[model samples]
Target: MKITVLIENTKGELEDLINEHGLSLYIEKGNKRILFDTGKTNNFIVNAQKLGINLENIDVVVLSHGHADHGGGLLSFLKINNRAKIYMKRKVFGDYYSGNILFKKSIGINKEVFEKYSSRIEYIDNFTEIMEDVFIITDIQRNHKVPEGNKYLFVKEGTKIVNDKFEHELIMVIKENKGICMFSGCSHNGAVNMIEAVNKLFPGTSIKALIGGFHLAKIPAIDIFSTSQDEIDLIINKIVNEKIEKVYTGHCTGEKAYNKLKQGLGNKIEYIRTGSEVQI
Candidate 1:
């Protein structure tokens, strides 16, 4: 399997591509080419063009969750590839907040965009299959230790608090003879929780690797409320318990948290900069 990062939060000094706080991973396994998320904006298109990625060749499009950073590039993606089937949660759109700022978000294909490619978009309310080897885990029901995720997150029906459990956040499992390669957007459902869910769904399967945002950057600050080193240790320990061999994390994963994870995971973690590629 080939996983190429089309957009990320950082880039190498020699790379001229502009940096953005978003995530977009392009996966190619066998005959399938899948686009995980669209990054924060049209910069994804610019970066893809720079990398010579033919977006039109993508066979499937999957939205990890309903945050703008992950789902924002859909309009541009749809413009290029109108035939790819889309897999997303049922209640995709929602209103969210990054601290004080409000963000209008959507998970699945945008309603307006979907109208144009309704036939190709496949909305997954529960679990669904894209191919014989690729399966999407859509049933997300996990709680977090901190009240950080989806606090201001909700759906809109003319004006209502649509409880969004982040069901739109699906885990993509690519079957390999060794195990499964897990691809996630933000894992708003908690990275460890998502892994546990995946393990339960597919018994005895081990995660070969994890790629995408873990959203650990939003871990509450100690100054405002109260946090302890032990809590951080606990979180890190849980991640280690998953037995994930490697991790490529960035996007909303703040520098402080990333550093902590780096310290904990050490050699097992590889920082994913924009335009980077990993083969497994």
Candidate 2:
């Protein structure tokens, strides 16, 4: 499998690539060409062009959650790619927000985009294999504590704005001959819980790689960690115990949190940014 960082929070070695406060990965597995996310803007489209990637030929597009940073490029993607099927959770159109009582901002996708491209969008509410070897899992078990940063995220229910339960978030698992590679947008459900959930679903299968943000950092700000040292340590312990071969993280994972994880996991963990590429 080959994964190319179409867009990410930080700039990488390539000076020409664009960076933003979002995440997007172009994945090529066998004959399948998949786009993990579209970042927060059309910058992903620009970066793809520079990277010699042809978005028009992409076979599938997966929006990992309802957050704007993850799905903001949907409009641009729909305008360019006419044939790829897009998959997301059923409730991903809910009003999602960030911040506390003092202030809040809309962090969800624009409903107009969904309405415009309704025919190409697939709303998934359960575990489904979109194709052979490609699976989407939404029933994430809450076996561990959710992200501390999640407290600031909210979803509208009736007339009340309540804490988001993250039911709209989903994990993508791609099965290969050696093992499986899991892709998460931002682990608001908790990385440890996600790992355990995948383990339970696919029994003795070894996880070769785990990619995407862990939600261990505060949003709307940088250089701030939302989780405590103890929580970070616990998460590191779980990754080590699970024997996950590699973890590629960035975006909301926070620089401090990523460094802390690096100290614990050593060369097992890597920070991915725009223009980065990985082969597994």
Candidate 3:
């Protein structure tokens, strides 16, 4: 499988490529062409063209969650790629917001885009195999610590704005010859839990790699991470114990947290930036 970073929070060595506070990966597995998350805007589309990635040829588009940074490019994608089926979890259109009661900002996808492309969008509420070896798992176990940053994320329930449970998040697993590669958007459900969920679903299958943001950064303010040092250590410990071969993380995973993880995981971890590419 070949994965190309279409857009990310940081720029790559290529000067032409642009970066944003989002994530998007162009994946090619066998005959299947998958686009995971579209970053926060049409910038991903622009970056894809520079990387020689034809978005029109995408066979499938998966929105990691309701967050705008991940699915905000839906309208642009729909305008360019009409044949590809877009998949997202149920309730992904909920009014997702970030910040405390004093201040909040909309962080969810544009409902207008969803309404316009409703025909092309498929809602997956349970474990589903969208293709032969490509699977989407929504039953993420919450046995481990969720992102500390999640406390600030809210979803509107009736007239009350409550803490987001992140039921709209899903994990993508692709079975490869070596093992399975997992793709997550922000991992609001927690990376450790995602690993365990995949392990339980596919017993005895080795997890070759995990890609995407771990949501370990401080929200509203990115200068410092919201996750405590102990929590970061615990997460690192869990990833090491799971024996995941490689972990490509960035975007919501703060720089400090990444460094901490790097110290623990050594060369097993890498920081993914725009124009980054990985082959598994």
Candidate 4:
């Protein structure tokens, strides 16, 4: 399977393409094309065009979670390819704010687009398979020491603002010849948990690659908090000890956090830019 990044926070030599605090990936496994998540705005489309990727060829669209940065572009994507089935967890809706009480930001998907595309959605709370070995994994149990939860990310329940349980989060796990590659949309539930989820689903399966947001990288320019160094070390240690071969991280993964991992993992860890591609 090969994955192409259509949208992300960083842009490389293709500086002409737009950038945003979002994530979108195009996965090609066999003849089936899958769109992982549509980034914020229409930047995914622009980057895909520049990368010579035809968005209309996508056969299935999978949302890792409900957050706006991940789910926001689906509306525009449907305009281009409306036939692809959207697979996601049920809780990916409603008002989600991710900032301090003084400055709350709407982080959920646009209600208008969600309503319009409701007919195309496939809510999968349990294990789901797109084709043969390509799967959507959910119900992760975070067992490692990371941020317990994001204090800034919350959900509104009537008049009460409560912490989001993140049931909406789902991961993509593709079985390869050597092992499996796990794709966590945001890792909001924690990377360790995501790995654990994979392990639990398919016992003794080796993890070949880990791609997508680590949620430890700090993006100061956008005011997103970074995970503590101690926690970052734990995460890196887990990845190394588990023997994950490749890691391509960005978006909310934070620049500093990624560099820190690079120091320990060397070439095994790398940042994936907007037009980058990874084959496994």
Candidate 5:
């Protein structure tokens, strides 16, 4: 199988273009072509053109979550590949935010974009199979002891907190000739949690590689006892415990957290830049 990071939060090469906070990847194996996430802007399509990736040829499109960084480009992609079936949870269309700033400014899926492609949408609340080897992990409730990050995540019915589990965010699992490759976008449910779920689903199948946003961007709090690095140290510890072979992470996985994880995971980890390809 082949994986290409068409768009990510940062640009590694000087010539690589940087789109605003998004992660889009191209995965191809055999006759199947999969577009993991669409990113926050139409730039994913533009950059994909530069990489010679024909959006029109995609057989399946997976939205990792509702975040703009991940799913905002759906409308543009749909225009190119209107025939492609989209796999995403229904709650992805619900409102999302990032504390003080609305998620549109931070990251969110605009209703107009989704409505435009409503005809091709496939809402998956539980595990959904695209092909015999490709799977989408849904019904992912946070099962670990990790902090839910903050109190910001919620469904607001006109500014009132409504009970919502944010069950929409999903992880993509690909079982190829090499092994299982996990593609995730902003794992607010916890990166370790996502990996563990994959292991449980495919018992004894080693994770060939893991890619996309892990969402470890915890900035410092006012006069907090520890720096954001401390929090990240714990997160890295969890990833290390998983024994994943290779990781290509960026976007919401913040530079600070990436650096911390790099120090711990060393060469086992790598940054997934805007335009790079990894073969598995």
Candidate 6:
């Protein structure tokens, strides 16, 4: 199987492709083509065109989460692949907000998209199999202390804004020829949590690699997660201890966290920017 980064947080060698604060990946194996998590803008469509990828031909489209940076481009994507079934958790359409009232922003998918394309969406609230080897692991269990670093995010409930439970978050786990490859969008559920969840789903199947955001990187100036160093340290230790061979991370995984992972995991930490490809 091979994964092509359609859109991420940066522009790569393909200079024409626009960069946005989001994530989108095109995964292909055998006859199957999967478009995972469209980025926050139509940049993915433009970028995909430049990369020689046909958005209309995707076999399956999966929304890893409801965050704007993750699922904001759904309507544009649906235009190209209108008939394809989009896999997502049921709560993706709920209202989401970030930051305080002074600068809060709506971050969830546009619910009206569901009204227009209801038949094309498959809402999974539990573990599900999209095909023979492709699986969607949903409702990530927080068995460990490593919460998905999204404390600043909130969900609207009546007149109140409560902490986002992230119930809508899910991941794509593909069983490759050699082993398992997990794609947890943004990994707000945390890398270790997502990996462990996949491992549990496929018992004894060693996870060879994982791609997508780790959410470990923080904006120090905002103090949103200034003390994430210890969390990154422990997460790195867990990654090494779990024997995950390689990791391609970006999006919300700020540069500080990437460097930290590089310093600790060395070559195991790979980059996932726009136009990059990973084959396994």
**Which candidate achieves the best TM-score against the true structure?**
2
Over 1-280, each residue of candidate 1 has an lDDT whose tens digit, in order, gives: 8888888877744286866777888888888999998887888888878888889899988888777777778887888886788787755654533432354434333456556666766877766667878889976556545325445455555666464566557898888888888788877777767777778787887778888776665432221222244545665786688777888777755556767777888988877878788889
**TM-score per candidate, chains pooled:** 0.86, 0.98, 0.98, 0.95, 0.87, 0.94
Minimal lDDT window, size 10, model 6: 218-227
Candidate 3 lDDT, 175-240, residue by residue in tens: 998789999998999988988999999998899999999888876235367778888888788888
Off by over 4 Å in 5: 14-16, 101-107, 145-150, 158-164, 219-238
- Poorest lDDT segment (10 consecutive residues) of candidate 4: 217-226
Model 6, 1-280: lDDT tens per residue?
8899988877678777788788999988999989999988888899888888888888889998888778888888888776678999988888998776566778888777789989999999889899879999995767755444576688988898888878888989988877888888877777777778887888888788888887765531221344356777877898898888888888787666677778999999887878988888
Candidate 6's clash total is 1
Q: Tell me the lDDT of model 4 at 42.
A: 85
Cα deviation of 44, candidate 6, in Å? 0.6
Candidate 5, residue 60: lDDT: 90
How do the candidates rank by lDDT, highest first? Answer: 2, 3, 4, 6, 5, 1
Each model's Cα RMSD = 3.6, 0.9, 1.1, 1.7, 3.5, 2.0
Give the distance in Å from residue 276's predicted Cα in candidate 2 to where it truly belongs.
Answer: 0.4
Whichever of 3 and 6 has more lDDT, that candidate is 3
lDDT of 6 at 182: 87
Task: Give the top-scoring candidate (lDDT).
Answer: 2
Q: Give residue 74's lDDT in candidate 6 (0 to 100).
A: 88
Sum up the clashes in candidate 3.
0
What overall lDDT goes with each candidate model?
A: 0.72, 0.92, 0.89, 0.83, 0.75, 0.81
Q: lDDT of model 1 at residue 71?
A: 77
- Deviation in Å, model 3, residue 207 alpha carbon: 0.3
